[model samples]
Target chain A: MMLANKQVVLKNYVEGYPKESDFELRSSMISSHIPQGSKGLFVKNLYLACDPYMRHKMSHHISNDVPLLASFNPSSVIIGLGVAKVIKSADADFEEGDYIWGMTAWEVYTLILNTNGLFMIKYTDVPLSYYAGILGMPGLAAYIGFNNLCSAKEGDVFYVSYAAGGVGQLVGQFAEMKGCHLVGSASTDEKVHLLKSQLGFDDAFNYKQGNDLARALKRHFLKSIDVYFENVGGNMLDEVLLHMNLCGRIAVSGMISQYNLKKLDGIHNLFCHISKRLRMKGFSEFDFWHKVPEYLEFPIQLIREKKLLFVEHIAEGLAKCCINFCWYLLWAKCWKEDFSSFN
Target chain B: MMLANKQVVLKNYVEGYPKESDFELRSSMISSHIPQGSKGLFVKNLYLACDPYMRHKMSHHISNDVPLLASFNPSSVIIGLGVAKVIKSADADFEEGDYIWGMTAWEVYTLILNTNGLFMIKYTDVPLSYYAGILGMPGLAAYIGFNNLCSAKEGDVFYVSYAAGGVGQLVGQFAEMKGCHLVGSASTDEKVHLLKSQLGFDDAFNYKQGNDLARALKRHFLKSIDVYFENVGGNMLDEVLLHMNLCGRIAVSGMISQYNLKKLDGIHNLFCHISKRLRMKGFSEFDFWHKVPEYLEFPIQLIREKKLLFVEHIAEGLAKCCINFCWYLLWAKCWKEDFSSFN
Candidate 1:
């Protein structure tokens, strides 16, 4: 049997900031039936996630350090995390009508040759779209960075950049639960308000409003930052170095601000690392995937009790995902995007 | 009785590279007798240490992160680590003929009001001048950075910058002792030869010979660096980041190259910290002073057994000390200086 599959493919390798024209929406015919003697699953992508790391995949040369994050070939479907339902399964681990989430392509239907990356969606009580953001890779990223890397403690003055973004929003909430003094920085006033009022951030600010990031940080972080969740890097990191308390920890999750630039911004205040006895570590969520079972318990309980809040924007189709992704990179709101309602 | 004390004092706060005229030598009259009812030590200064950190103290504004490292006040006697013989004592802990080493003024005769910082000479078999370099702050700094912070182990690929300097030389030796495959970088061919031939490093390169630091590092570090003992920070650090292997650790002891500049050079390859899952920490020897007793055992045995070697250049008299220090900063040789034979 054959099925018509709609996909968002890379038109060309992006240089600097990406444009919507860099991606193309096309339809192709894919086999709906699983071939005999091959253990594979044919999946119908339900909820696709738009994330910052996907931008790196669009580039021609990706760093060899992250072997799992491979670059996207021209005319190939954009690869990302998505929630999908197994349509036809030859693998014993997955069955028809079962919902799963993992690395998938930006298409209505996907032939998942490697099922090892896929995870069976155990909890159907929560919205399946939630698996694309709050309960998926973004949630896991926040858990590893804040808990495993930063070692956030009570009374710690925690500061996070891109506070309204998928991982940042969750880190701020985790800081609040740990009894830390939480402060978050966003690009817009709306995101700042959302961070403080809805996301449980102690205080939030619009970074674009002030040219002086040092003064802004000094004003909000009266006691100085003890833990910093770094999502955006550049001058922001340089200024944060000056305001960090002695022995501060910075968890480098992503450098969204530098990802699009041909030349990365140079950080000038690294001397603070020596003077302040500071420690900075860079990591990815994939590094701590083994801890997923241990991590799921904490967030799942808080989410059920309404103690945690997540923000997201849902786009309806494969074509809209490309437009929404471009917008997502430009206007870095603290909300994750779920490309749902795919036909 | 009165004594003519010849002292070296700071003329003004230094702007760039320090000039010999920045220090002024003057004669003052001081009582040889310890004042009655005062717990003080009247001592004759024997040896003073010329160190890179003293350049920071010469500046008007120093980072408040290191409270112990305060800036110099104009017209005040330069304070530094020195060895002295007690001429007179008003304290019960010290006697008239005891030999001690601690923070002292750059003068022939000094009245130390606080004797708490002073340490009595325990081992007499070692050269008294050795207390100024190998057995002093630099030695302790190397021990703490390589052993405690870097967690260096056998078969590790260890790299050290400014490997002929006071701290760098010792760190290279420690790395060698730990059975690590050591590679060291120095400024001159002579220093590079000394690092490889005399210091037991597996490989040594003259960084000044090559304009491309990345290529120099790549040529030497074929297996990539597992641990880096960083002394000079600037372009060297930026290049080193590119060649670091997965889970690499950088122990930042100092940034000597940036100390003299009004504006520090910016580091651009920080993204490698994340992709490589690297960890970088900055610290001073003072932070781990409590572990001194435990650290002393390892190096002392090595020195006594002729397993470890130290390098130094001795400059006689207080007046020549100022000239030698100016030269030391410009031509950063791997040798420590002892301003002995003061009159």
Candidate 2:
């Protein structure tokens, strides 16, 4: 069967903060039917994750030898993590109507040539959209960043930056459940409320309130942070460095604040490392790939019991992909009730 | 017997760059004889070590809970590591004229009340002043930071900042001896020449030439650094961060650039850690206390063989102590013939 695919394409390599104009939504034709004996799976894309990390891929930024995270080759579809349904498959491992998640483009349909990176969905009990977030790469990162890397102990003073967002919410709740005194920062009052009231954080603050970040950190966490999960780099990281306790661990999951800039902001006051004896480490889901099976059971069970909470913002339609993505780069999420609904 | 002892005392807590007036020279008197049955050792200070780490201890820099590295109690003699000879002793472990190295105040005569931190000077074939740099705290730090922490391989592309100073000089020679491709940075042309000619660094640069540090690093190494020995921790460290290779290791030995400042200079390019899979660890000599005996044999033998070279800077009097200490803070040692006379 022949089908029309609506896709998002990169017009040129992004310069600074990406606008909707950088991405072009174009119509293309594809044959939905797989060739006989071809080991390919034809998928109908459902929920595509609008991750801030995708911003790094939009720019051709790096020294000559350093590898790009994701290279957005012009005229090709912009690919990202997505939850999709296998409509037809000539691959023996996949069956029709089976749900799977992997690198799918921001489009209605995808013909996956190689299933090497794809994961077969075994459970249908949870929401399919969750595979794009809490049960997927972000979930694994949240687990490993706190438990394995941070080595967070009970009674540890834990701090999370970008605390009400995708990974931070899960990290706060999980570390809080582990008997930590959790303090987190968000950009808005509503998100702070969600963090403190709904997400099991001990305390939360709106960083945009125009208070000094270091002073606010000192006020909230009296003894300074023992374990810091650093998702937002730049000034947030700079302030966190000041309050980090001796021998403190910083698990660097993302630098969303630094990623979109033309000239990345400088982190002054790194001198704290000498006196405080801080350990700052950058990590990704690739580091924790082995722990997925072991890490999955606890969060999935907690969610089932309604003991674990998560705030998800979903955008419908592939055409809205560019518009929804622009929000992350601008970092202007108002965190209104409509933007994030907790379950 | 009464003996006159001259000592250098901290006049007041230093504000920014320490001055000669920050330390006052005063005559003190003590019994030249040891007290009967009292556990004390009376020593004549020989070569006192001048190190950059002392800058942190001069002021009240830490929070209440955090431990002070060393507090410079006002009107008291400034204390640091020194090579001394015992003139008298009441302890059964020592007799008259036994050489030792440990913490001794800036004075010609010191009565050591406790010898817990002292190490017996076993061999004296080398210069007695050798204990000040190549065989003391600086040497131990250089050994452990690279061997124990960095796990530096033979062919690794190694970079050292503040490369002509105490620890960096030793680290460069040892790593070069290990057959690593080494590049180093110093603050003067003479120091850069010494790094290339005397210390055996493959290439070296004077950072004070005001070239863009990141570009200079790229030109020298050709590839991103695999191991970074960070002694200077301002913009140079920030620049090194940009050119670090994947799975790069940075041994945070000292931030000499940060210590004396009321506000540490900003490290702007710390954003490079995320993509490079960098591991930056801050360490000190205390971390390698156990490795001293096992590690000492290697470098001491190299020194004996004349294969390992180290530069020594000597300040003659307790009065010259304050003046010489300023060079490390200003980072202005010309590294000319007078600064290092070792062949």
Candidate 3:
């Protein structure tokens, strides 16, 4: 048996943008059995979700319970939505070797106690790792944010920001399935092509190369934007506001653009939201977890039928976890550079 | 027939903030009757509403349809919502001395030919000027912005910004009549007092005195806000975004704060709207004008029963219309010192 375990832990709460310096890989001792009378599971994390919302968790508290989904604690292992195999369990419901997916840590192994809302992943034919992402939080978010909040309809026009990112990519395909015209904005040429070609977006633009995002959106969506899935806020949101149709809808899932700045960039064109009778809503997957089974059924069937597609940028090992996390954040920020060279 | 056509005309499309310099009083020839085969009415204006939304119309092409609402021609009279008595009529529907109201010019006497959707004010026992304001466009806006957009319910905690303003003041009162607890933010001691004392608000605050509008809101509403009737935007809107409850509805009628702003203010707290699953919407009165009968009955009954109260800052005559319009804009921008004298 390995006497020592390799694990990732929180170094500190990140300020501005997240960096590798914000996480640490440390060694710890682990035991298979829980401490007496403790309701804990020895979870061996198989997959973790790197999401846009995690950037919000990296910052210190702006307000008490600032984030409605979950709050972060300093000096604790950074928690995330993950798929884990229960190696051992003291709880009555969970058993050894049960594939479980819920909130866990950015670690190789964790003795998770006080589990809230943990469930066994009974749907085994699908990729187990999807429990961490598309089949999990982001997936649920895409469904709820689009369906319940925006009340999306067939033939509506959709413009998703961070279109090549985790949730946005999925949302584009979902919109198409609903018979809506889908458009998206990515940061890289490769991502833009991936959105239009691989992800089946009607059109996609590289916001980095675009001179005026409002004008660019106008070119693609000649009629007007009916729904905007806002992932990257600030100037992008501002531009989206200007191009919205009367009675348009905006879903505020994340704001990667403002996460790094001390003073967030203000949207100058918000008044257009009023003029257009636009509906802008903020949402998280937690609120709509009740609809997971109903939501998962269609997507899972789509995946098995080879109707759905997704991309995963994976890191090699526990030793590279911190840097990989940083890479995810950097990529989300539209910073294209090989941080591996520095590492 | 007195052909002395004393009128208030737009000097030019206003740039930045509107000023008295942007409007001119024009003496023009008046036609006493509608031309043959013309569908119009000649009327004497009774009262005109000095509204903040008119400010957007004063500026050139603020958006696509802003010019239509503003009638902001270089040498044309400033037009707005008003109550009038038809003095001479060629249109089949309107008769001589018939009371009517809709969109009209800020003038003493005028000819309205080719009227579209203008209605005759049947029962004029109630204040005729109320049709120009509280019982008119502002009232319709409050009803639609709250009932239709926000879908306000009993036991809901409703919050209103610019609570002393035309629409804001009425919405808070309307919510109160529905057994909802209303909280409002004004810019002065008198306005705040009026909200709590006369309008039946549960609590009220002077936004100017409170450095942190969000904290002040939290103090007033220990529970989460269910519906937000937003008028003043900027920091106030940013703060309100933080305290909204899940599935909370926000009626974004106008963002008066950013209207005259040379550069728009940023709303940093918009991300909170998603986390809370908040549904924020922008709207105008005309969008839901078909529901006017139902809207009029509730408020009219409230006024008849003396259950709902309202206040207006009238400018007296059309010669003072340009100055009054400027004062309305100034008051919206928190330049209260100037308008305070009139109130």
**Backbone Cα, N, C clashes tallied per candidate:** 3, 0, 7
Computed on C-alphas against the true complex, the DockQ of each candidate is 0.80, 0.59, 0.70
CA lDDT scores, all candidates in order: 0.85, 0.81, 0.78
- Chain A TM per prediction: 0.95, 0.94, 0.92
Q: Model 1, A132-178: lDDT tens per residue? A: 88889899999889877898899999999998888999999989999
Worst 10 residues of 1 chain A by lDDT: A334-343
After superposition, candidate 2 runs with Cα above 4 Å error:
A33-38, A62-68, A287-298, A337-340, B31-38, B59-71, B287-291, B337-343
Q: Evaluate model 3: give its TM-score.
A: 0.93
Model 3: per-residue lDDT, tens digit, A1-343? 3446776777777886677777777878766667889988999988877766776777776565644445477767778878899988999889999999887887788788876667689789988878876788888888787777666788999889988777898888888888888998988777777788788899988887757776677678787888999888888898888788878888888887877777777777778776777878787778666788788786887888778876655556776766766777677453344222221
Query: Can you write out model 3's per-residue Cα lDDT over B118-151, one digit (the tens) per residue?
Result: 7788656678888876778898888777777878
Candidate order by TM-score, highest to lowest? Answer: 1, 3, 2
DockQ of 2: 0.59
- Per-prediction share of native contacts kept: 0.86, 0.56, 0.88
Best by TM-score: 1
Candidate 1: tens digits of C-alpha lDDT, residues B221-295: 889899989999999999999889888999999998988899899899898887888899999887775665676
Docking class of 2: medium
Which stretches in model 1 have alpha-carbon errors above 4 Å?
A: A332-343, B33-38, B62-65, B332-343
